[model samples]
Each structure stands twice: as structure tokens, then as C-alpha cells.
Target: MHDATEATTTPKSDDELKELVSLARLVAYARENARDLNAEFSAYCLDLAFGALIQDLDRSGVSLSHESGQDSSLFGTRH
Candidate 1:
């Protein structure tokens, strides 16, 4: 989860990028697959925005998914 207190200027870590992409995909899937056009459009916009985030992370060499490892649970760790 993002918080107002967290420094927004710092680059996201690999873990953060992975989690962010996962969440973006989840939201896009749920919203885009809905019966309403409004929902689909909202999902499209969200997907577009998240795509930029993905590209930025990609440029930094962060992968969207792990091939062979346990995925970290955000709730399991605390800053």
C-alpha cells in the first residue's frame, strides 16, 4: 500500500515493481471483464497508466513475474 509519508521520489525496488504490476493486472482483469462499458473504460484507462509504470520498471531491469521462487506477501513484511 502507498502512504503519503513514504518518499515518492525514490525509485521503486524490484519487489515493489513486481507487486505493483501484479496488482495492476488484477485490477485490470476484474474491471475489464465486467459487464458494464463504464467499468471496461475505467479499466482501460487504469491499464494504460499502469503500463507506463511497468515500462519504467522494465527499463530498470525489474521483471513482472518470477519464474522460480516464492512470491513475497506484502502483508507478511513491514517497513
Candidate 2:
């Protein structure tokens, strides 16, 4: 039910292309690793990606709850 023209259309912007590439990589990784429903594996992959993002943000000096010593939005309180 999908259109061939739509499938062949280019991404609108660099941001869109990056998002697509990231999603494709995630999907490929999931397919290769998560053979079943594998909730634990999925959660591990999500956590790994999130930790990488946090590291990137930290390198860019983009603080979350780290400066305020408060609970993070996703992970809750830090030790």
C-alpha cells in the first residue's frame, strides 16, 4: 500500500537524514541482537544510546540535573 515515489524521495534536511540513519542503525542492531521480544536486550540498547547522548551533551557543556544535584528526568536520583 506504499508509494514507490515516496520511498525514493530524499530527506528534507540534514537533521532528518541524521534521524533516519540513527533509526536505521538501531533497527539493524535490534534485528541482529533481539531475536525474540527480548525486553532486557531492548532496554540495554536504549540505555547505551542514552548514555552516549548524555556524554555528548556533557562534552558540549549542556547540563541536565547534574549541576543542581537533583533527580534526572529519565533516570531519577543520582548517587
Q: Give the whole-model CA lDDT for all candidates, comma-separated.
A: 0.52, 0.46
Query: Candidate 1 versus the native: TM-score?
Result: 0.41
How well is each residue in 1-79 modelled by candidate 1, as lDDT tens digits? 7563453456778687777667755644554454245676676776666565555555556554322221223112222
TM-score, one value per model: 0.41, 0.37
Q: Which candidate is the best by TM-score?
A: 1
* Clashing pairs in model 2, backbone N/Cα/C closer than 3 A: none
lDDT of 1 at 24: 52
Clashes per candidate (backbone, < 3 Å): 0, 0
Distance from true position, residue 7, model 1, in Å?
A: 9.9
lDDT of 2 by residue, 5-58 (tens): 653453345565455445434543453355345677676775466555444334
